[model samples]
Target: MISKNFYYQLITRVLGIVVTAIVMAFFFLKEYNALGIVVAIALIIQTSLLIQFTNNTNRKIAHFFNSIKNEDFTLRFPENLDIKSLRELNSSLNMLNSMIQKVYLKNEAQEKYYQEIIKQANIGILTLNKKGHILFVNPMMENLLNYKPLNHINQLAQVSEELHRFFSNIEPFENKLFQFSNEREKVQLSIKSTSVMLNKEELLLVVAQDIHKELDKNETDSWIRLIKVLTHEIMNTITPITSISASISKFFKVGDSIKPINELTENQIKSTSKGLDVIKEQGENLMDFVQSYRTFLSVPNPDKEPISALKLLDNVRLLLESSNTNITIKTIVKPFDLEIFADEKLINQVLINLIKNAFQALENRDTGGVITLLAGINENHTKYIQVIDNGSGISEEVMSEIFIPFFTTKNKGSGIGLSLSKHIMRLHGGSIIVVSNDIETKFTLLF
Candidate 1:
């Protein structure tokens, strides 16, 4: 309808101009010089009016667009114009501008909301361009660094030179730990970086968290667990020694004084000898336990080399099978050539430990126990080996203590296997994790 109205107005104006020119020509041809001059003047006025009318709409549209480009929504075109086409055009533009303004306001509000969230976040967040220009740094980040108004990565030198170097050389999609001392306290930051594209510009989005408290808590928890296990193991050995020593002492002592040798019975002497032997055995066991603990604490750095995952799994399967084959053993290596750069010996120890645990978990099952030795790359493109078992799975209560040294449910278990495995993985810059249910258990060694 608006188009029709606009075309009608345009056609009418053109017809008027054509008719005025024709009339002016006729007057001139008839030799009516004064009338011809008057008609020619009127024709010029009509043509000027038509040009102005078209330019008016064009100017309004251009101005509206310019206002939008500059993010200014204050420009309002008059809707009470004499022409219907002009009035309708003005109203439609006003409506469109109003809608766009509302959307702009909404988006602005949302951006502000997100910015507020970032500002109040507990963890530190910062974005840097390739030139190290800090695009955005939240208040939490400033607080964490103990330096405000952080405008560039180089400004990290104001906090610590080492921190500046860390930021400068940080790699994307990797986690790094940085420790530095400020005036207030020692800060242990767990930092991670990733690439983010904003407005067609690539930025390094780095998130840093003050993990000092968490690390302290974890250290304290680990100490407590170690103490508990140590106390339990030591007391087990010590209590027996104490009891046997007490019993043997009674054979020779009378009211805290040594009895005469002639008064000692043969059975008493034999009992004393047996008690001494028992004490010696317990002392040896205690020494071995301490030695194991020492070994756990002294895990050497990995001698890394590329080792085929399939070969590793197969070797472990063969080693475990040579002793017992009651449980069905299976090997799975994805892509047939997946490999890991790690100490082959240390990795073998970890795999053996996990596979043994799987064997133990399935030992009680009568007929259908299955242990799967799975080797592959995980979703993160990290190499991993899984020892999965279809058996009575590990209970949650036992699972929590499985990684603690000398904490075990088995009667004869020294409880060093899983903990040692975890330590070896840690040395290799890897990790071990376990998941279990009533029907199955899986231990994954990630590198």
Candidate 2:
């Protein structure tokens, strides 16, 4: 109907123009005809009215587009336009405006959610541009940094160089440690970063978490465990010794004072000697327990150096093979020249520990099992060494306790192997991760 309206409008204008021209021609050429004059006047008036109608419709269309550009969704058109085509165009514009309003509301709601999450997040977070300009510093960041509302990443330079360095050159998917003092309070923060583009501007969305309290809590827990173990061992030794010594004292009789040791029977003497011997044995065991605790507590500082990963694995393989000739060792290094910066001797010890663990996991197999040593760089360019074993994997219950010093599942195990490995990785600014399944147990050292 709208298309037909447009067609009729065009034809009407053309016919009116032709009629007016013919009437003017007759009036001028044939002296004067009243009817021709009247008809020409009428035609002119009709064309003027048509031009005004076209202008009104054009004005309404222009206004509708202007409203859209200005984001004025409230601007509404009346549905009673006389021209069918103009009315249909108005209806379509109104519909489009309604959809835009709905979309705008939805976006507003989503933005609100984002703001709430950012504000309440526990981790210190901020968005920074390539130029190091900071934006959207969350409350956690303010508290963590102890900075008066930061305006730029460089503002952290006022706090400490370590803090400044962290926000300045952060990379995508990077996890880094930053230590610095804010006033008198020293802070150890773990900084992580991700890349994002918001409002067509590239940003580094960084998070900083002050792990000082967490470390303190862990230290407290370790101390508690050590105390518990010490208490248990001491009580086990001292209780028996105390009972035996008391029994020996009963042999002496006080006649005015005390009985002479020379008057004791052979059975009493034998009993006393046996008790002392037992005490001596228990004392020796207690000493061994204390010594193990000392070894566990006094992990040597790492002597870090750049060492080829393959060579490290090979050294570990040679060491393990020399002791246990039955287990097969397979070393695989991707881009075999991959180098890890760590304490060569310490890293070797860690590798030996993990490989030995893998071998032990496979020990009971009827067929000699293979221990796999793998080295590669992850997508984030982190160097990793994995030791894999196809054995009965670790149980969930045992896995959780494996890294605790003196916690173990095997007989004759002192249980510090995994714990010590973890300590070495931390010293070298890396981590150790373990994954166990029915198929295999994998221990990965990430650097």
Candidate 3:
């Protein structure tokens, strides 16, 4: 390539001759013939070379510009050419290529990061352009719609009415939500739709959050209130009969002692006494059952305090340990020394009940299966305490009723342990959720 400095020098030499000719034309007119011939030949050669150089430069410039326009970053300026200006052009082009590559890589990484973040999220996200065509859909959205995103956007409309409502609400800057349900399950989804202006075009972004569990909880609470009403009504009807029976028996006994009648009255008093005793025993049993129900209903407010988690676990272990050789308890504490606010006594009771139930679950086994306690904090900053058991796992049909009062798998149970524990956690502003599979059953306490 020719250097810029060398080209400038050649142009300088040409201008110098032109200046000399103009000077001689004015100063030496009589000796013009021989000098004019030699001067004319020198001018022709310089002009011809200048024209050829200009054409070559123009063609090379055109080719370089064409290569860049074609997006061909791999093309390079020819090496070892005599053109000096081309060297400087090559250097500039190489720097531009490096900058472009760096920008491309940076943008690629940003896109990948955005995709990973969206993929990990539980919420479903979908985006659409102004023409109502789906521009982008994350994996969560794909799974939610039950269709491949690469498929036509129209296919989504066939599966979900909530999706249709979401798309319709995107226009006019309005927010909307819809409910979707099948025979087996129901879902309440809170949906938000908004138009985003980018490069003079409007796009839509839709975000959906699942609120099905909240709906189901509300339904459960309604059922619990109904049960409370029925229990209260039954108690009201039984208390008067129980009081009347006791008073009549007392009167009969007093009359028997007076000896107003004969042997028949004595026999009647004996029979009445036995009947009274039986009535009292039955009444007391019913009241005891009612008292258990009352305790479950009157859930106490939590006086939350910060306590060492390991200490609470130790307390639970000490409280539940028995002399039975078949029962074994193992506890493993994580290295985290984090503090949390909760009702320690209530939490201890919850653990004790869970451990007791786990031990009971292994009745048929030669030796009780291991029951594991695990504690950890989730990425959402929620504290999770889990009781995992390897005993006979609960079947799916009965799993749903485990939290309901008087629903028990054991024959002699009051059926209020899990129910009471669930209420206590609710009072403490937490939750107890159970997940059971074929091999294991787990109760997760989330705070």
Candidate 4:
């Protein structure tokens, strides 16, 4: 309607000018000089009015766009005007401006909401561009690092030079542990990074947490578990020896007085010899258990080298296949050329232990027992080897204690294989994890 009215107004002005020009020509031809002069002046005034009218509308539109470009939604055109078309145009511009303002305000509020969440988060949050200029640093980050108003990655040096270097050289999707001393106390931070694109520019979003307390808690928990296992094993070995020794002592005594050797029967003598032998056996077993514990604590550093993942899996498969003909073993190495930088000997030991566990898990299966050795690069581009078995999976009650030394569900065996595997992976600066369900169990060695 506004457009139609504007066009109509424009046509009327043009037609009026044309008609006035025709009248002036008629008057001039008739030699009516005064009327011709009056019509000529009237034509000039009409032409000026038409140009001014169009220019006014164009200028108003230009002003509205300029205000929008400047993000100044307050520029509202006056809606009251003599011309209906101009009035409607002004009302439309005002409505558009109001709508835009609402949208802008809504966006601002949402941005603030997210910013507040980041600010209040427990973990440290930071973003930096490739140039090392810090884009954002949440309050938690400031509190964690004991630095405020961080403007650049270089500013991290104020907290710790090592931390600064770690951030500067950090790669995407990399995780690292860093320790530093602040005014308050020593802190250990577990930091991770990922690449993010914002506003068409690449940035590194770093998340960090003060894991000092968590690490301490884990260490304490590990000690408790170790103590529990050690105590249980020691008590198991010592209890029988103690009971046997007491019984043998009673055999040699009469009413708390030593019995003469001549007064003792042949039966007592035989019993004494048997009890001594049993005590010696238990003592030897206890010594072996302690030695194993020592070995678990003293896992040697890995002799790192590139080992073909395919060959590693195949070697393990061959070693275990001969012992178990009823079970099927499968090896899968993605990209066949994929390799891991680790000690072949140590890694082989870990794999063998895991495979043995898998074998045991599948032992009860009557048919279709399968143990799969899968090696490849994971989503984070980290090298990984997985031992998977289709069997009755580890129960939830046993899962948590699986990695603790001397904790085993099996009736026979010292139960240190999984624990030793975990130690080896940790020594190699990697980790071992397990996931199990009713159908399958997967143990992953990540490097």
What are the TM-scores, per candidate, against the unseen true structure? 0.80, 0.75, 0.49, 0.79
- Evaluate residue 204 in candidate 1 and report its C-alpha lDDT on the 0 to 100 scale: 96
Candidate 2 TM-score over all chains jointly: 0.75
> Which is the winner by lDDT between candidate 1 and candidate 2?
1
User: Model-by-model lDDT, in order?
Assistant: 0.89, 0.83, 0.72, 0.92
What would the per-residue lDDT of candidate 2 be over residues 285-341, giving only the tens digit for each residue? 777766776876787888878899888888888778766666788899998788888
The residue-level lDDT of candidate 4 at 18 comes to 100
TM-score between candidate 4 and the true structure = 0.79
Off by over 4 Å in 1: 1-4, 32-35, 74-82, 129-133, 152-157, 161-181, 186-204, 211-214, 236-288, 294-308, 322-326, 337-343, 378-381, 392-400, 437-439
- Top candidate on lDDT is 4
In candidate 3, list every pair of residues with a backbone clash: 1-81, 1-82, 1-83, 2-82, 2-83, 2-84, 3-84
Q: After superposition, how far is residue 398 of candidate 1 from its true place, in Å?
A: 4.8
Residue-wise lDDT of candidate 3 within 169-266, one digit each (tens)? 45645555667663345556777777787678887877776667667787888598548644754565467557767765564466557434553456
Cα displacement (angstroms), candidate 2, residue 237, comes to 4.7
Q: What lDDT is reached at residue 34 by model 3?
A: 73
Q: Candidates sorted by TM-score, descending order?
A: 1, 4, 2, 3
Question: Which regions in candidate 2 have their CA more than 4 angstroms from the true location?
Answer: 1-62, 65-71, 127-135, 145-197, 200-206, 229-274, 296-308, 318-328, 339-343, 363-370, 395-400
For candidate 1, the per-residue lDDT at 209 reads 96
